[model samples]
Target chain A: MKVSAIITLKKDVLDPQGKVIHQALDGMGFENINEVRQGKYFEIDVNENDPSKAKAIVEDMCKKLLANLVIENFKIIGTQ
Target chain B: MKSSVITFPGSNCDRDMDVALKKFGFNNKMVWHDDNELPKSDLVVLPGGFSYGDYLRCGSMASKSRIMQSVIDFAKSGGLIMGICNGFQILVETGLVPGVLLRNKYLEFICKNVFVKLDNKENAYFKNINKDILEFHIAHNEGNYFCTKDQLKEIEDNNQIAIYYCNSEGKIQDQYNPNGSIKNIAGIFNKKKNVLGMMPHPERMIDQSLSGEDGSIFFKNLINNIK
Candidate 1:
């Protein structure tokens, strides 16, 4: 099974890196850019076929390693 | 007392902390960041430096190192842990210590010896140190300590405010609040008071009139309390 995890800063948290990128894009004359929010994507290969088990494992990984629950949020998607 | 200083790739103050601990008759060792096992020591010191090149936010990468798991485990078992400057950032990143360290509001690297008034003398780390002004050096860009209003109040009410930046008169001046740290807090302790993380470099001020010796008392008091 293949799983993809997308992690992003929580809505209320400040994203300094994203802001810097937004500024750079503006400097480059890309006027259409309104805001830029940065996120991390991870692709994982899990041997388990059960969607519930896979979701549980991904959630554990996010809680323990992939995301900082204090300031970030994460979502996991997989082929059921 | 037995102490070990964890050295990351970019840590420049490991030797200084080792020397300070040795001067206080401590059996000190330098543990590498990649090592998962901690030395059999009473205390663990994460000294300051640009760990992981200060990339991905200060201390963010270093917190994910292999050694942090063991450090976190040791801390959970009630062992003493102290993180200074970059180390403090690492502590926050690892979630071993509460709160976050943001970039200096002025966005400039601050390097100077500043006065910190000891707000809590009951901890082992501050026992011998007077509940008054002590000078220590701080050099970092991401040293501003921040927390939510309610969390700040909870920390203050719990006596976790270990040290506060102050002026020559030992008063916390609003304008002189270096780094825009909330409550002018320079250091804080975990709920159990066993873990301490501060931005000031106590190891740099161990020698009086030389390195500005007021900081040495921190080590002395910690060792004495452990014994």
Candidate 2:
């Protein structure tokens, strides 16, 4: 099974990189950009074939490595 | 005292910290990030550098190193831990310290000797140190510390605010709050008060005439109290 984890900073936290990107977009004459936030996406290939087990494993991985629970959130998506 | 300083691949301040510890009569060892076990240490110091090249974010990658697992365990066992500069960022990334470090408000790297006021005297790291202004060097781009308003309140109420940026006159003014850190916090102690992380480098200022030497009191206090 292949899983994807989308990790983003928690809503309440400030995203300086995102803010810089937003300013850059404005400088390029791009409009309609209400807000800009940055995140990371990780794709992992798991050996398990069961959907439930894969989900659990990926969630564990997110908590352990992919996401910092103190300041970030992560969601897992996959097909088994 | 038995102490060890963890050195990531890019760590440049490990020697400075080691020298400071040795000057304070500590038998210090340098533990690499790849090692799974920390030296039997009463105090563990994480020296500053661009760990893992600050990949993904400052201190983000280094927090996942093999050594941090042991550091976390050591911290859980009530061992004293101190992170300076990049070390501070790693502490937050590893969740050993609370809050996050964002880029400097000016969007540029800052390196200079700044005044820091010792706020918490009860901590072992600050024991016997009078509440006064100490000069230390800070060199980093991502050093702005942030947390929620309620979290700040809790930290204040718990007496975890360890250090604050101050001026030559020893006044903690909003303008002197380097990097726009919330509550002007320059350093903080964990809930247990055994772990401490700060942006200023005490190791860089151990000699009074050279680096103002006032910073030596921090190490002297640690050596005297941690035993």
- Considering every candidate listed, which one attains the maximal TM-score? 2
Stretches of candidate 2 above 4 Å error?
A77-80, B208-210
How would the docking of model 2 be graded?
Answer: acceptable
Please give the CA lDDT of all the candidate structures: 0.85, 0.87
Candidate 1 CAPRI level: incorrect
lDDT (Cα, 0-100) at B106 in candidate 2: 63
lDDT of 1 at A56: 84
Q: After superposition, how far is residue A53 of candidate 2 from its true place, in Å?
A: 3.1
Candidate 1 per-residue lDDT over residues B122-174, each given as its tens digit: 77788766548888899988888887667788897899998899987799887
- List model 2 lDDT by residue over B43-134, tens digit each: 99999999888887789888989999999999998889999999999998887878888878767799998998888788788877764778
Which 10-residue span in candidate 2 chain B carries the lowest summed lDDT?
A: B123-132
Model 2 gets an lDDT of 0.87
Q: Could you give the DockQ of candidate 2?
A: 0.38
DockQ of each: 0.18, 0.38
